[model samples]
Target: MSDLNITHEFGYKNNPNSQAFIESFHSSVQREFVEYISFNDIDDVYNYYMSYIYFYNHLRPHGSLKYLTPDFVFYLFNDNFNDFISSYDFSDFFVSVKK
Candidate 1:
């Protein structure tokens, strides 16, 4: 369903957690696109969002992910964190200490 249709069907609720997440997402959007770019129409806005989503998930490097794209980390780890721990060099984070 379209976002407009959803808005028409549902009334706003006083959900603080939902509101906080939405506010954070909007702040990121404002900083990333709305501040520097202008959309020509609904199509333009949709296309821009699609491109941004691809870039954000597949191309952009995140600090929290240690400068890796979400897709890269997702596929590499693939829910098998044990393999990641065994294969990847974590020497920087894990040091052998002499007691």
Candidate 2:
């Protein structure tokens, strides 16, 4: 890790709350996706996660984000907020899920 200039940081000792968000995300991924599939190789795992991440950020609406996709909220705040608001179309921002 040192040779690669990578530094690993751990949560505060015995402070589970410090890692709550990541732990929750891990649990969600395992329960919602990983449990249902078998990976053929490392590349397959990587490809699966890449698509899943795109769906998670761009298509899936998060309750914690007021039912908005993360990509929507991210651009809403990072871009010119006022311009984004003025040109916003709610119909395009949401995706319909099929049962």
Candidate 3:
């Protein structure tokens, strides 16, 4: 096995902006799927996660995306995603950062 060294950082100490989003996603995964589901094996785990991730990105309404699914927002603002993101209000999601 390969040794991988990683640092532990609590909350958003490193990057307040993006860290909040990352934390929220992790929390959602725990709450939405991990807490209640059990997998028979590795393949089952992989398959379930693949479906869940697709649903989360394409069908779920994210408040940060203005209550739009990421897929819709992505296509709607595909030309300049950064520009579209800059105009929207992220406060809806940003304010609810966990820890």
Candidate 4:
């Protein structure tokens, strides 16, 4: 890190709350996605995770966002939020993909 001119920051020692969000995401990924997949190689892992990330952010409805997708929430808060909400029907927008 010193040679690369990068500063490594550490969370407060013994403070679990500081790492709660990262822990939660890791747990979710392990339980929901990683547990089910058998990867052949690093490329396979990378490809699978790339698709999963797209599904996670664009398709999956998160409980924390009141069942709205992260992408939807992002658009909802954008400058044209009202225009988007008025023109788009999210109820029938979802397409089911078999894993």
Please tell me which predicted candidate would have the highest TM-score against the true structure: 4
lDDT of 4 by residue, 2-92 (tens): 9999987677888867887777778879987899899999999999999988878877887888888877899888998888778866764
TM-score of each: 0.54, 0.67, 0.61, 0.69
Error of 4 at 59 (Å): 0.8
- Local accuracy of candidate 2 as per-residue lDDT tens digits, 1-99: 999999987898888788887877888799877997799999999999998888787777888899988877887778577776787666756677799
TM-score of 1: 0.54
- After superposition, the stretches of candidate 1 with alpha carbons farther than 4 Å from their true spots are 1-25, 79-99
> Is candidate 1 or 2 superior in lDDT?
2
**Top candidate when judged by lDDT against the true structure:** 4
**Candidate 1 lDDT (Cα, whole model)?**
0.68
Q: How far is 96's C-alpha from truth in model 3 (Å)?
A: 24
Global Cα lDDT for candidate 4: 0.82
TM-score for candidate 2, please give it.
0.67
Candidate lDDT values, in order:
0.68, 0.81, 0.75, 0.82
For lDDT, candidate 1 versus 3, the one ahead is: 3
Query: What is the per-residue lDDT of model 3 for residues 59-99, given as tens digits with 9 covering 90 to 100?
Result: 67888878877866775767877775677555432334388
At residue 68, candidate 3 shows an lDDT of 78
Clashes of 2: 0
